[model samples]
Target: MEVPSSEELLQFLSSCLSQIKWRLKSNSKRRLEIDVLALCTGMRPVVMIDYGGKMPELQNRLLSLLELIREGLPVFKDLKVMVIEDMIYLINVRSLPKFVSSSLDSEPELFFIDLEQDPPKMVTQSKESNLGMQLRSIQKLFSSTFPLDDSNTDTTTVLDEANSSQTSLCIDLSCCLQDTKVTIPTLNGWLLDYPVVYLFGTDHIEEAIYNLSTKSLRLFKVLVCRNGTTEKDSHLEELTSAI
Candidate 1:
């Protein structure tokens, strides 16, 4: 049988994120966008949400925010890291976003290393991650959102309060290799870690840059699932606020 498609893998991964199957968008709720972005963008690991039109607006904002950092806009340095992850989740990012040239040891061991006689080609990004790399040759379409920052936070625009920041998601073996290997038994999870400056509330979204200067707050995260063509109005304000 052919392998599971990326969308299927995404669905499965989202299910795995929630530890359930039904009502992902609503169940995950407020945490939806933040949760998914943390996964897809974190230098460490994990997206399970879709915010409709608002999603695109947030994407444009995030992309604009990220580009500012690329162009040396010191005001937005803190947000630069998440920008990578947000880029993929915000838009139909197909080709890999060119790696920003990082030092080695920035990530854990590549999962692909265990296979093949000669060590697999050494690269910063691939079809899968360290663990995903080791499994069947599945796609790693999106790469880690970390690795692109300056060595320290003293030089950026976001998270000015904390000395250093990080975010992580607990992922299991299934995410690494979905359809390629079936009928597998109980699975264990590994912690995907990433650097991040956490914000406390949705209002913090407005103060993202300012909050970095405050030194006492947490980052935000969320997860979601697609439900037909219409926007669910129940959480429209919350979702719109997040976007």
Candidate 2:
């Protein structure tokens, strides 16, 4: 994928900020938009935004902004927003390129935008400062969540590990906001594309199966069969063999 030049990215972000300012009625919401632009363009992997105890309001505002970005910007489609305590975290997985390319001991410079000034201003925080500590913490969290087994591996290998049959995957929906309702057509579509065997559970079995099957389909054509019931292991073995 081609990365955008700094100037091009800034111009696009400026336009987005202007539109957000014009559309959002609340000052706080507009400020959130500015913060988001700062972090995203700054290429910070994970940074926390203080919601000031107004999580519900900020979450709705953030979701609206994310939807807008998702529809208009293909580059940020993989961006994930997570709420933890009073802080809202914006994780740009694309930022990993800069980290992966740099020396292991090198500290990353942090960027922030000051919109109070004319034309907006980009501020760079040195790696020697306190922000560096926070940056380290952010990197630690990111690395823990998505561990890289080999530093020499390409970015695609780092992010896309679903192709490995031995990889045990855990689909955590709590970290994200997703529509749980599954239609018959959607299920049929999934069934047509891949070999999926449903594993019914005590609760939300369809949603569970949908999440697993859909994510699996994105990586490669592989059989996704989960067992939540008391079915015998022999039965599952036979089913896979038959397929």
Candidate 3:
């Protein structure tokens, strides 16, 4: 079976997130020895692609994977999302009890996917979906990281713990600052600069503002605009705060 390239994974994530919050970047620091990392709106995210746990007999490799995820706990700001691909089929065929035992955390965004499909999307239905949903308990984590956006004026919804001493790294609004016309040299530079993102826009770019202001499930942290969108088109007062 073929695997989706890193580029493909980025695009897939962009579609899921709406391409606003993250941009693909290389693992120069090799944080967690990850093959791919992306800059997210309020946090940095790491994606482990095309990885299936080692054979049950190879306990060492499996243990290593667990340690890597555990060590990265603080680095991810408690928001680690793992999107599995064809590996689900492998698990279904032979129950890997240990790997399942390891990922049973309250936090971390867990997704089940079938790469063989034309578009390579998340698995929403069937037997595997139920198991995946049980393991992905993302709410337990986000309940602590993000706060309820009761008002439209709230732009940065980072929780207090994120700013506390426990979490050394905190995402800020500095990334959106621009007076200079910065030139990104290459694709690598683009990824490094933009990183991986999830965008939800109203008109593909500004469209997200309307959705974000009204709805609570914001997929993006930083809002992207091409022609300088303003509150004229959007009804919410907080629409201006997204960028």
Backbone clashes, each candidate = 34, 0, 21
Best-fitting candidate, scored by lDDT: 2
lDDT against the true structure, per candidate, is 0.30, 0.41, 0.27
Candidate 1 deviant stretches above 4 angstroms: 1-29, 33-58, 61-77, 80-103, 113-243
Give the per-residue lDDT of model 1 (tens digit) for 90-185: 221211222212212324433211112122233332444433333213222123323233252232222222213332111112232333331111
CA lDDT of 225 in candidate 3? Answer: 28
Runs with alpha carbons beyond 4 Å of true place in candidate 3:
1-112, 115-122, 125-131, 149-164, 167-225, 228-243
> All candidates' TM-scores?
0.22, 0.35, 0.20
Model 2 scores a C-alpha lDDT of 0.41
Using TM-score, give the best candidate's number. 2
Which rank order by lDDT, best down to worst? 2, 1, 3
lDDT per residue for candidate 3 within 1-243, as digits (tens), equals 454443444344334323232222433222222222232222222222223333332223323333343353332233322212121110110111222232343112233332223233344323343223322332223222233332422232333323333222222211221221121111111112222222211123333334334444433333332222356743221111111
